[model samples]
Target: MSPDIRDEAVEMWFGPQHVSAHGWAAKLTVVGDFIVECDPHAGYFHRSAEKVLEFRTFKQGPLVLERMCMLEAFLAEYPYISAVEQIAGVEVPERAKVLRTIMMEASRIHSLQFWWGQFSAELGLFAMTLWPWVDREFFLDTFEELTGSRHAVSFSTPGGVRYDFNEKVLKKLDRALQRLEQHLPKFKDMLLRSPTFRMRTKGIALFSYEDALRWGLSGPNIKACGVPMDLRKDWPDLNLAYDLVDWEVPVVDNPDHPGQSDAYDRMVQRFLEVETSINIIRQLLPQIPEGPIVDPKARAKTNRLPAGEAYGRVEGTRGVTTVWLKTTEKAQTPYRAKIRGPCFASYYSLKHLVPGSTFADFIVVFGSLDPYPGWWDR
Candidate 1:
């Protein structure tokens, strides 16, 4: 608050150039090693995806959505598809429901693996970084087998899915899961139990459950604060098959923090998220009935949707992702499409969470929130 302290504070930008920043940047005011202020920035990666969605046909909108967050392509694309399905009144078949759930859970696992590797690398644990990424390739391989593309596989479409689970696809998916299950224990022990990792992450970027909710945090970030606020259970989609499986929303109750979460708790929470997703996939895989993977009249139905408005929400890998859609009568494309990405709030919360922490730990706090620039920039 004093003039002398202000004189000593040095202001600097943390990226559009920083290796860790990717398509985002932040302005930080530092006094020696401690950050006196943080101004989190967005818009660097803006691609007008929401506007682009309005131009795409009802059935073609998922392709644009998937590109926003390719790591969870299946999850990323579903919200748009969900909206289109609602407006068109297209019924998703039982077989399609089961398949969509299975692949969505698989996409969740793939995304978590990518996050684990990236977060570890940001913490300067390079070895831990490559370990999970190597395992992640198996998931990519499975995705390739299923949709003939890895990252931007437009797997989920309005009224159903684009691809059916062939025996080859099932075999590849099982092998990927097996590899992840086998290596996850060892990876967790190596990273979570390490003294170095604890020294960097434990008790860092701490936020109470109430504060997190106030900041609009969700997914593992909220789950780590001892709240099981998962949309999969709380707001289940009738078209999806989550209700068929018996599963509980994973939550982390850290005794030391008591209704709060630190970086360590969030890291643990993501591990539990991956496990829960794997369990869901395992249960749903067997129940995938032999029938149509898409609605018989889906193409005809989605050709011209009646005038309506719909909200599509999904419990994504990062958090609660949603799409709000509006259409005119006999419209070939959406009249309006708006996306509410989970990362936008998480990135904004950095202004509150980063100040008073050391400059070196800024990335740790940012990465702990698991923000993807596309989520916010769009």
Candidate 2:
């Protein structure tokens, strides 16, 4: 409120050049090591993916969607595929349903592993960073063994999945899961029990359940506030095998801050997410029924969708991801496509979360949300 304080405020941009901020930037006004104002910027990584979707065929649409967040490629592409199946009235086979669920959960775990490492590194814990990344490569190896590509696997399609689970694919998946299980406990203790880690994250970026919902935050960010708002349970997809598995949604109800989540709560929430994904995959793997991998009429049904609009939604790695599609009668491509990526809200919330914190804790606030640039940029 004083003229001296106003005159001393310094403005700075936090990235597109910062090592941690790959394709995003934010402007912060600081006064004596404390942030006074924050402005989060987007469009640095935008490729106009929604416009590009209109030119690609229904089958090709998922491929484009996966690129938006390759860390969760299998989960990212499902919304588009689900929309196509709705318009086409295609039935996915039981085998494909189980396979899709398994791969999607695997993708979720892999994505969380990446976030775990990156968040640790952002806080200057370099040893914690490399540990999870080494484990993440096992999941990538499994994906490559199955689909011949790691990040952009193009595994799922409308009415079913493109690749069936072969013996080699299953073995690789088993290996990855086993490796993760063996090491996750040690890694959890290292971060969660560390006094230094707690000092940095415990009270940082605090948000209430009401504020989170108002800002449209979901997934672990909201779950950390003791709310079980996962689409996999709330709005179960008929084509996916989540109904076939018995697992509870992972949530972190921090007693220290009831109905609110701080940076440490979010960190604990992600660890729980990885565990739940593992449980889902383990249960579904053995239950894969003997049947066709895809519908026999999928090709004809999806070739030219009838005039209709459909919305597809999934509980993605970060939050609720969705694709709204419109098509004309006998159209090979969509009339219009709209994508809603969850990180848009998380990134925007920095304007509110950063101002009261010290300048050094900016990345702590951002990393806790587990935001991916492609999710917002696309």
Candidate 3:
């Protein structure tokens, strides 16, 4: 290598910090204030969750799976549980389906608010961070009241859920979500609607729609690119949730360029998903049936299926999360498990996006994508 080129760039490390929220450890090659290249390290966060799933009984697996991400624990657990149920040929009760839908929506609200808070916090908007948590508490309260625990409830099971959604609790949840809707405008004004925030984010970190697709982005990331791709919308009637809920997949293409997606659009997409969750919660509560929450014979102790394999997927707050389960005849434990973590694609694509941007812009881009580093290199 030429001495001049070596002098042109210097290397630096972003993190491998003991308590990083995103658990990232990246090495960057920079020229002055601009990043020339970035090589992100991943092993620091590998949990090997798929391998761990093989060691636990079907009912016990979710207990560990929920540990993959703190903010979206329940959402991470859903795909795997759905996989197990499918391979076992388990039929969920109508009431249980309703309960699952409600819980999934509620949990999604928690995750959206979480990322909202993190996004605000990243920009030094501490007050906005606190504001979203207040709304998120409404959903967490509902979880605690219904499932008897807050995070990692493990309430979802192969046949159905571990508990029923009581009418009174549903009423309480409805009231809480309605209250959350009332406070949305204040946050919009503070963050998304703020002129300063727009100036910083609107024209910055713009990626082409094709680039978004090539990088395998999902959730708000891809939606912001105008792809309108959603597992719920693409896969018909996986259950009744997506089909019956009647929700639109929010798409946010670049305003200036008309065909691109930007950091601001990603934030806008997230904000819209928050509103959609409220709508979903309201729609499902009244529709919840009065029936058994679980099928008696579908309990894990009695699960003895013929050897087979099945895959299940669901749209999570971050994106589409998929799980594959293979079973041995009459075995209560899975012979193998494979997980498709939502944040992994974005994690790998960071190198392509980070170069040629200022160090200041780095925070904006990373904060916008918001990949949970725990999901990477695993």
Candidate 4:
């Protein structure tokens, strides 16, 4: 190589196993330590989610959806449940609606906590790891008490949730929210305020607002770019009971950068969302109505929706997670069923950010965008 050239461009793989590679792996073409191109790789874990759901009855489908998103089961489960309930023409009780909102926000916090922990570790903030997990127990405890499991929470049924809300779990949720709120500031101080984080991420991995719209980035990813595209606010499901709550959707912006989408902005938007989720949980618990959790008519697989089709979507912890289902009177099972996850769209956009940044910058950029391989590849 010439002296001016320094190093010839060579390809490198970052994870599926790299310690710093947060979610999955990516292939990178690098000149020295700088990446010239990037290709994110997934499918290391694929269970054929749609195919598994298609053959099962409506009541049994959530079991498969829950596994698709290991980090946020509610995101996958809610959309499928809503799709089936809509097709079945089952009315979700008012109590179930508020409870679902509580779980959704809780799950949102759960997902962010996991992301933050990994991102912090990537930034060499080992101390940051302990706090999120310490606080996470409160959320998991609430879930375990509610559903007898911590991770794969297949809690929602077709018409409504499988379990009823109890005073003890609500009390635990209340206490957990308080703990999370109190501890939230430490993350901001340790990571967001750290010059290292800002320097590494503030303007790196930019996705312009126009690009966000064109590429269909959703949730906090697009919201960070000032797109104002929250499914909860823009397309609220009746069962979501979003109308019952009073909270502003946060489209986080970097006042310093002005009309920009960067890794820092994305992280900040999700950070703001974490606080919003806490507030939502507090707002909802007092207002949850007292009634049966699920209609008896909905718990069974025999309940047939109209032969037509319906699509159900939720403002997932990730983004606007969706489910499409088609039914026919000729057979009890769904004729067609599938899920659409948000991470899939953002995956292709990786090369757009990866090239023109250093290899280390690639990790920060990828982690900030928070792509999940498992969400796709199925």
**Candidate 1 lDDT tens digits, 1-378:** 478999999999999899999989999999999998899889999999988988999878888899999899999999988888887877799999999899899999989999998999999999999999999999999999999998989888777888888889999999999999999899989988999999999989999989999999999999999999999999989889999999999999998979999999999999999999989998888888888888768857888999999999999999999999999988999999999999999999999999999988999999999999989989
Residue-level error in angstroms, candidate 1, position 122:
0.8
Report, for every candidate in turn, its global Cα lDDT versus the true structure.
0.92, 0.93, 0.78, 0.80
Better of 1 and 3 by lDDT: 1
Candidate 1 is scored at a TM of 0.99
Sort the candidates on lDDT, descending order: 2, 1, 4, 3
TM-score of the candidate numbered 3? 0.94
Model 4: what TM-score?
Answer: 0.94
Candidate 2, run of 10 with poorest lDDT:
291-300
Q: Give me the candidate number with maximum lDDT.
A: 2
TM-score, one value per model: 0.99, 0.98, 0.94, 0.94
Q: 315 in model 4: Cα distance from truth in Å?
A: 1.0
Task: Show pairs that collide, candidate 4.
Answer: 15-18, 15-25
lDDT (10s digit) by residue, model 3, range 1-378: 357866989998888762333467778888899898888777877777878888888878877777776567667777777877777677778887878888887888888888888877777778988988887887788888888877867878878888777776677687778877898877877887787788778767788878878888788888887878888788753443656687887787665776677788888888788888888777877787788888878765336656888888888888878888888888778899888888888877778888888877777787788788766644
Please, what are the lDDT tens digits per residue for candidate 2 over residues 150-172? 88899988878888888999998
